[model samples]
Target: MWRELALGLAGPLSPMRQAQPVGFRAGQAVTQREWRAEVAGWAAHFAAQPGADVALYFEDSLRAAAALFGAWHAGKTVWWPGDALPATAERLAAQGTHFAGDWPGGACARVAPQPEPEPEPEWQPLDAQAPALVVFTSGSTGEPVAITKRLHQLFDEVRALETCFGSRLEGARVVGTVSHQHIYGLLFRLLWPLAAGRPLVAERQAYLEDLTRLDARLALVASPAHLKRLDLPDLAGLPVRLAAVFSSGGPLPDDALAPCAEGLGQTPIEVYGSSETGGVAWRQRAPGADAQHPWRALPGVDWRIEDEQLALRSPQLGSLDWFLAADRVRAEGPGFVLLGRADRIVKIEEKRVSLAAIEQALLALGGVQELRLPLLPGRRQELGVVLVPTAEAWEAIETQGRAAWLAPRKRALEPLLEATVRPRRWRLVSELPVNAQGKTTQAALAALFDPMRPSARLLQREAQRACWAIEVEARHPGFDGHFPGHPVLPGVVQLDWAERFGREAFAHLQPAFAGLDQLKFQQVIPPGACVELELQCDEAGCVLRFVLRSARGPHASGKLRFAAAGEGA
Candidate 1:
């Protein structure tokens, strides 16, 4: 099977050739033959708009893969944004691009996979070197960067993956918890399985509960973000057992892998690579493996340590030259042990960001004197900046207030950084947290962002409900919006606080708001009042009900409904 598959990987592309089930949608099998017909139909439509640049966004993996192949066949360059957020679409739309999938901005054209009844076109091989994809990265240094790829670049990585793990994943159906828009999911979830003749689950399995519905012979393509949250006991009741599991996009902690081993009967095959340098190395931890376990380089990948950083030479780069990576590693037992990062750049929300560049930008600003930008803990995907403000800025905060003082500082950073990499929360401090050696440490900086150390304190907590006893400071900026003479907490601020508390208390709550219902602000919550803010989550109805009360009685009460993240506002 491996030899036959290897020959197929090297053979001419046949889009309409049927070998395995491509996907299952609505209890209907989407065979490779039917998928190819849809691709050909969309290709003919796209071929009409020759030379057009199209931005593709799809919630469905099968449709996304079809559009990708269809656009490439039509000789159109496909732009893949990480998300379909309006801001992202608007920014790329300014470059005169057409939109596809369910994106709701602009007058751009949309394409759907509609398999026509016409004759199935003969399979045609694609140009190996043709520019097919343009993937945007949160710039490692400053602004966002675009990485272009030809068909061969992606195919090289896919071939490498199949060559490495094809036999073990034999007859396994592909099911992913990651999005197909990014490189990791694009290769593992869609491209690799498609090329290797494996069936796939069409919709992304967002919740762990959904995985219980899956049948047998499953191969899970997931990310560290999803795997880190999985508890061993939660996976005990899974209907089907996974044969092979793949993880990427970041380091998968040992704890996350333990559950995969216990639940799936296999250690996760963690692939270490990036969009630019695909599948550099892989490692499957043996039982009792320690942090010092080395990563084995993939076939056709040549790796060397360059100035303490990991550098690779592979066909995945579309060239023979070595591409230096941000990771630092040292040789250990025919593989390499990963050290910490050599650069000050990090990935938040799978988007690359340069901490050094952000620090430099902030130091250049008039108000910021010294600062440290630390990636927030868990999957929040945000940066919390701790700053020792300039004397002038501190004075302004005292006189002009925090909301007014912090507004311009963030606005000043707009020209230098993308919104994805921007620091969302700003903390003002008199001094920096440092070690005995006087170096600002990550742990020290992270401690400053703890909500417990801040104004909010958890008074009582339960599974779905938490009561916070908050004393709103008189000088707090949130009071600026309500009347100046009789300062009261605004309805908007109350709702925002409710949502924030709900997220902090209930870690599994989706952060997206679906709707607001029966909101009543009966009394004014004045500054300096000690109020009890209670949050109750309705998981069945997908609603979060909140009430703010004090001795003065119900200040505010409302129900804020939230959909799963990415279901739109």
Candidate 2:
């Protein structure tokens, strides 16, 4: 019956007399009647431009849903970009496409939900097999892949999800930390709840502090990246209690899961799937459940281990053909245990190296909070590592020097991994680089190794002021690939150097960074240019002002804000 309703196979719609609440916007209820009316308004608005493909980008789920359904009603398809960043806009422009979002690019006229919907717009059923949505992969492993979904495939997957977990979530209000643009968010946060008659919260809960406002029963649709940062103290006395929490996008480490279950009311149900495959398998580790719990395949999803890779055939695919996944797994009893991805294995010096195995080994080391291991460019087969040290490890480095801090940890890994597989170069950073999707990309990972972009020299020091002379050369990383014929230091590199120097010279800004503000770039510094860096720490020690100047004029200036020791953004 759910599948029939989802696939528009349930018969003609009857007029609903009373307004059923669909969601909340700014603490105000949005009714089913209003939503349908909005959909109708959008349909009429787009009908004039029928058969046009639209790139949709809405941060609000309710408005996004109205636009999506309206587009389908008008016989049009919707495209989703990986993000709304400038780079994504450039990519879309390269493809000669226009977008309909809250962004600035005026390639297409923006369509928003009507402030007040029209009265009594007629309802209509959509063609079940028409192409509906285009979703892009996270691009964590490689370039993002675009996958198109027919209405049947998407609706069938929603039905399957409801059948598997809907009973436990009945009557639960929907809340999310993840963005509605991704597949998990599209299904769980919007479509599933809409079909289940559950109301959605308008605002996205980005910070742990945001969860404190929940006062009702909730079905949280979230990702591991967000869940790992849960703060127990901040979540206390919330107006809302969680009935179920759903996590996806990446593996939920045991370290994060235990705390989440203890802090929240229930253990999270982690969904294992990708953009191409909707909801494949799920697992929830009870307080006393086995440490090596396997993920059970969803209802109607048939799976098999083919050449160590997981393969599936389900109605969600709109056919009986098996779809192969990159994940390697082993069948255990009625389910399967995922053994990393086959693509993570790389060759170094003609020797096979398992990047996953090395990472897992490194994670087992004490004082390592988070880390990423990627192979270096060229045929040398060497590896590069970006590591985020735990507070304890960072303290050790501050007190004992970097070599003393790294010696024992490196020795511990020596017994577990081969020399060829060990990372040759490592970078320590305050946090990992993540995109809007909370997934780190290969490009972001490689950018951590940017070679000595700026050389710094301490010129003078005083009680509250410090001065440094910096030099940028042609071989600097900031200049490479910035432009074909011309090269200049990027503003981000300048800010990074300022922050690094500020931390070294001032004791107050140590530990964590809050944010940067009041940034202005007046001039571009070319190669082989020498510049002066001036920094001042206020009496309160929470703010630092930095300025970069050359013989001509100021290159850049910004104010760096710091949160004391444990407090940070």
Candidate 3:
């Protein structure tokens, strides 16, 4: 192979040339080819520039990949700000040389328009150790760390794809649902397809319904977050033949795996890897499969356990030969079983507790659709659980006779209600806050119990003509027992007040108490602290709003909802 820098190199011909009909809008398809040509032109433009770094902000996956490759061909480095938040972008820009993307009002220089150029010859290879890309990982301590990947590391990763799965992806069109900015998306969707001589799908399938309209035997590159959204009523009959389903980002729960197998006629192959190590291991969701221990390391990747955590050394890491990960894994003969992340464990009452374990336990309970465990900040060890009940679970909890439908732990924990976090604080929510990749952010988890950030939308609001005002002192009698002297108002009581106000505002609305939506206890409101109550209602339902302020500081503010008795009642 020759080595040089030039964009738009024609891929090597592969024997498998099945004209796989990919599903994409005509405009998008045309734009993909156009974007490729434009990227080649941009590569030439960048070749004339001094620095070797470029920032990309394009939303379209194909366009982003084209820009990324074009920069690489010009011997430039790609800097991807995965979060894309203003603070994150500023930090990246400070260290980066040039930036590209559609972000509005940022300090980075705008990407210049591409100029037309004559068709370039095939791309020549550059030094394998040449810097190719920079990806930022969320630091264990909440800061971000920039990890660089070399050309050779990227090539090795793409080469390992064949060994990771039994099938050859030659000539296979790749359509990814995950963002190209992330490691999983970058490797599976762009590099692997390019190395295998496959044409990449320019558009991302945002919804499961979009799959039905697609024309190719899709490889459905997805994350556990996307897989959870799929509600397959009957899996035995579907038109599409999925070559394979790949899941990463987080663990694919056993419950999610079963439906994917029955519906798609193929078990989802879970991938275990991180931003640092690239691709590591693979496992299939088969009957009696061990989720914790089924992972087999990819060929050419060396693995070992150190202090209960898994570490990997691979040819793909360039100068960095070894990378230690936070995943807790135990040896299983030739392979390993992944226990949750090492950071996920918390200590309570001198006993070690796994929030992930508690979440899995709560998810196993009947009527629970989704659950999240968030730790409260205080002297006492408090675990807060936010839950969204299935309709059946909702009915069972609301009707006293139906309470038997719950498991013992769920029943015991349900009464701690919306406000207090004791053995557990259970707050019912319409839906959990999951990010684009389907992973829940710690910020989002903390927001759940935060009474300050209520999830309910105010549909309608009307001040009472004859306002019935009440000033109530906030107090949690159990707080003394919870910590003995450092008492704080329970989150459930704050939610309860909101519900009571809902009943008061919509007197004619017949507030059918559905369940607690969501609640958060930001700063504790102490006993004897006066809280002002406000109430409102509309055609959709009612809302109870509370603003609690004390001489110390702003205590908490929140809203609650009561579903209307009927559709238009």
Candidate 4:
């Protein structure tokens, strides 16, 4: 195979015939020739536009790739925002960028299917020094910041990826659960496959079962959060072993690694880098591996310790100068074991505390399944923990109360954590909120403490339905004036909640309220009670059915009717 086909990027991706099938667009095979014509058409269209910078957003990876390369081919710089949300579009438009591909703002340009080139369609070589992309940080730390990447940086990283893992993934079909809007998804799902001549499945996989249903010779680009909750039952009926599996955002959790490797018949390559670092190092969890398993650097990447921090100089940085990273590491033979982030340290009452240490201490508890510590800002800053409790603990919480659930766990942490730095507020949730990048940002973690939002955690979701875990505390606003001493969830509040959660679970709900039928308040839901709210949408009849139940008994159940579209306000 040629160098470009085997381990190169950008110059001539996949040294193969244009007529060969490059990928699948929504399960339909698209030849490289057709893709070239699309790119050419997009290039011509954008080339005639005025601005040098344009904001691009697309749910379809092929369309995204076409627009990306087309924008570059047209000598235009691209601002790759993390989502197609209205706010994101407005922000990009404020920067004076023309919107392209599925954005809600302006007259967003859509890709023209079966576009014809004025002349013969051809792939043009992109300049290595060109300003290629401006991507945002995952906002895991704080507010998201913008980082620009030169064409050479992308070219270098893809080549590095090919050099590192090309052999194992040769001729594989790339599929992913992560969106292409994010940097990790863009690289692993689209760019890497393009460079390797691998076929890419356009649509993002929703359920874990969706990934397993595909045919042989597959490479799945996934996130750690997605893999951690992997139920082994979902892996059943898989016909063949995947060629490779790549995880970004963070290292795969210890429990998740074994099942993935054993079940998939391949060790998942966990890339340890962020949007800022690009691809720094990668490692696979071996049998009985712990923190002892170190991350090895990619080709052409150099790493060194500077003041107990990991410093790197990668081609992805587009600079030869060593860039110091915030993460602290203990050097192994040639690789390094990540200790924790140095910036996660906080001070309380003249005492320094490692927030990461506090998290580790809580995670060690059997009752806590997953948790995130969000720094609650006030006159005096304090730490608040959002916990997704274990099944047994949640059962106890549901029966006893949220306070009852948190009391013993907080007591258990007394030995491992300092009193000053311990979590001041505890919020039980079903899952951590994640952004489009499959990462939980600082803002998201903090939002759990918001009083206005429903104190409910969505436990399960299916088409036209969702299950939420609701905890009504003694001090709940709904219990304020409902006959003080005998405070119970009000019937009117139950009706209001049904409508609110109903709209959230079912997207097809009309804006206007019509009426209700078969509404019943069976039992009194006392204060400090935990319950499950099941909302099922009957789209055909425009009725939303809700059932609120717990271990005690059924509290409320109702069928809510809604007006059709434009029927009422």
Which candidate comes out best when scored by TM-score? 1
For model 1, how does the per-residue alpha-carbon lDDT over 1-569 read when each residue is reduced to its tens digit? Answer: 22222232223335544644678875468876677776776687677763478888888888887887788777788898877766577678787876777687545445555764765665456777877888976555655678888878888888888888989887778889988888888888888877777878888988655776776578888877677677566676552467778888877776666666666667778888887787888998865676678899999999898888888999879888888887888988888998977666687655566676667667766677778888777655688977777777767876886678778778766654557667887777655655446677777777666643334545678777878767677766777757869897777777878876676566567657788899999988787887889999865537889999988889999898877778737
TM-score preference between candidates 2 and 3, better one: 2
lDDT of 4 at 427: 78
lDDT of 2 by residue, 1-569 (tens): 35423643224334662366788887788876676677766766667663467677787888888777777777777787545656456555565544676655565545554645334544556777877788765333333456888888877788788889989886778999887887888889878887777898867777755766766778888876667677788778542477789988776666766678767766789998877888899999876565368999988899999999999998777678899887889999999998876666454442334565566666777778888886666424368877778878777876886668677667655643446456667766556655546667777677666575354445677757988777676788777787768888888888888876675566555467888889999998998888999999886677889999999999999898887778888
Clashes of each: 0, 5, 16, 0
TM-score of each: 0.71, 0.60, 0.59, 0.62
* lDDT value, residue 535 of candidate 1: 93
Which is superior by lDDT, 3 or 4?
Answer: 4
Question: Which ten residues in a row are the worst by lDDT in model 1?
Answer: 1-10
RMSD in order of candidates? 14.7, 18.0, 17.5, 19.1
Candidate 4 TM-score, C-alpha based: 0.62
lDDT comparison, 2 vs 4, better candidate: 4
Q: Judged by lDDT against the true structure, how good is candidate 3? A: 0.61
- How far residue 384's Cα lies from its native spot in candidate 3, in Å, is 7.2
Inter-residue clash pairs, candidate 2: 214-239, 214-240, 215-239, 215-240, 216-240
For model 4 the local lDDT of residue 446 reads 76
